[model samples]
Target chain A: MKPILPFLLFALLLGFSCSRQVQRIETDTTIDLSGRWNDTDARLTAAELVTEIMGRPWLERHVSKTGKEPVVIVGMVENKSHEHIEAEVFTKELEKAFIQSGRVRLVQGGEKREQIRRERADQQNNASQSTMKQWGLEMGADYMLQGSINSIMDAYNRKKVIYYQIDMILTDMETNEVVWIGDKKIKKFVKN
Target chain B: MKSYLFTLVFALVFCGFAMAQSSDQNPRAQQAYEAYAEKADNSHAASLGATVDKTYEAHDPILIKEQRREDRREFRRQLRLERARRPIIQNNPFGYYPYW
Candidate 1:
C-alpha cells in the first residue's frame, strides 16, 4: 500500500510534466530546432533573391530599350536537391517579387495558363461578344526566369551540415540572351 | 486507514494541478517568445512607423489571416521534421514511406 501511494504520486507528477502545451507566438519567431528548411529560410531567401533580381542592371537596360516594363514568365525549375524541394514555391516567390517591385510584369505559365485559355475559350462561345476577352491579345513574355535547387549534406553520427544552393537565370526569350543571375546559398549545421 | 489513502490521492491531484499551472510559466519559453516579439516590434516600427512597444494590431484583416496561415504551416513543418527524426519503433523494416 505504501509503494502504491508513492507510485501513484510519481505517475501524477509525470502526467503533469508531459502535458501538451500551446503557446501563441510571433509569426516571425525563428524556431529551427531540427533545421531542415523552414519558413524563415523560405522567406529570407525569397526576399534576398527578389532584391538581387530586381536591383540588377538588366531592368534598367530592358526598360530603356523597350520603353515599358518587361514581361517575365516563370519557367520550370529543376530540383536536383536530395530533398523533395518544390521548385514552384521558390519561383512563385520570384513572381511575387516582380509584381511588388513594380519593375516587371508577370505572366502565368504551365497548366494555370492553359486553364485560363480554356476559360477564355468557354467565354468566347458562351458569353456575350462585349464581355469576351480576345485570345490573340495575350501579352507575350519578354523574359523567362528558371533555376535549380541543389544541396550537399555531410553527416557524422548525429551531426549534419547541409548546404543548399539555388541558382536562377533570367534570359531574354527573343534573343535567348542571359540577362541577370540570382544566386541564394544557405548553409545550416543541425545537431540531433 | 481509508482517510489516509483518500488524503494521499487528494494531495497527489493537487500537486499535479499546481505543477501544470507552473509549467506554462516556463522561463526559457517566455524568453524565446519575448525575443521574437521584440524583433517583430522593432521591424514593425521601422517599416510602418508605428510607436515602439505598442502591441501589434494589423490594420488589414487579410494580413492577419495570411500571417496566421503561414505560422500554422511553419508549426506543422516543425512537427513533421520532429516526427521524421524519431527512430522507427516497430519491426516493419521496409520503411514503407517512400520519401523517408
Candidate 2:
C-alpha cells in the first residue's frame, strides 16, 4: 500500500500538470483550432464586406438621387453551415461596420423597433404632452440588407477542407429592386 | 524497473510528437493564409481614406457600451501611471530627512 501510494501521487500530479490552460489573447488575433466558423472568420468577413460594399457605386448613385445618406435596416442573415453557427455574430459585426462608416444610416428593426413603438404608445397616456413622441414620424428605411452563409466541407480520413461563402444583398424598400450584391469566400484545410 | 523506464520514455516521446504535430500547419492552409493576408492588405489600402473620414449619424447601444468600457480602461491605466510615477518614501528612524 505504501509503494502504491507514491505511484498514485505521481500520477495525480501528472494529471494535474496536464490539465488544459487558457490564456487571454487579442481579439483580432486569428487562432483556428477546429478550422470551423470562428470569431476571426466573422471579423474578417465583416471587414472585407464593409470595405467592398462601401466602395461600390450603388451607394453614390443612391445618394445622388436622394440627396441624403441611404437609410438601411438590417434583416435576417441565414446560416446554412454544416455546424451550428450563430448567424448573429457576423450580422452584428456587419451592422457595427455600417453604423461606423458614417456614410450610411441605420434604423432600429425587429424586436427593438417593437419595443420603441410600445414605449411611444405607453407615453401617449401616462407621460406629459410636451415631451411625448408622435407616431408616424419615424424615419422609414430606404434599403434593407439581408444575407445568407453557406459552407461546403470535404473530408478524407484525417484530411479535411472547409469552404465558407457569405452572400449579402441590399434591396430598395420602395421599388423592390435589388441594389447591391456582395460575397466573400474563405477556405481552410486541416489534417490530423 | 526496466519496463517502467521504457514506458516513461515512450510516453515522453509520444507527448513530444503530439506537441510537434499540433503546431504543424498543412501547406495548403499556409497558402490560404498568405492569400488572405494579401487580400486584406490590399483592401485596407484601398479603403484607407474612406474608412478614416467616414462619420455615422446614429450610435448603436453596443458601440456606446464599448466606448464607455474603453473610457474606463483608459482611466484605470492613467491611475496606474500616476501611482507608478509617485516617489517611494523611506522612513528613517533617526529623523524625517529629505535625503532619507
lDDT digits (tens) for residues B1-100 of candidate 1: 9999999999999999999978766579768878988777423212211111212221433445679999999988987786788765566687553334
The list of candidate 1 runs beyond 4 A from truth reads A1-19, B1-100
- What is the RMSD of candidate 2? 34.6
Kindly report which residue pairs in candidate 1 clash with one another.
Answer: none
- Looking at model 2, residue B46 earns an lDDT score of 29
Model 1 error, position A110 (Å): 1.6
Q: What is the TM-score of chain A alone in each candidate?
A: 0.86, 0.88
Q: Clashing residue pairs in candidate 2, if any?
A: A102-B55, A102-B56
Candidate 1 matches the true fold with a TM-score of: 0.59
Standalone chain B TM-score for every prediction: 0.31, 0.33
Q: Give a tens-digit lDDT track for model 1, residues A1-192.
A: 677998999999999999999999996688997567677777777877888998999999999998999999777566676566655555677788888888899887666677788999999899999899898988988998877777777766566788888888899986789998888899998776
Q: Residue by residue across A1-192, what tens digits does model 2's lDDT show?
A: 689999999999999999999999899998888676799888888888888888999899999998999999877666666666565666676678778888899888766677788999999999899999999998988998877777777766567777888888999986789999988899998776
lDDT of each: 0.76, 0.76
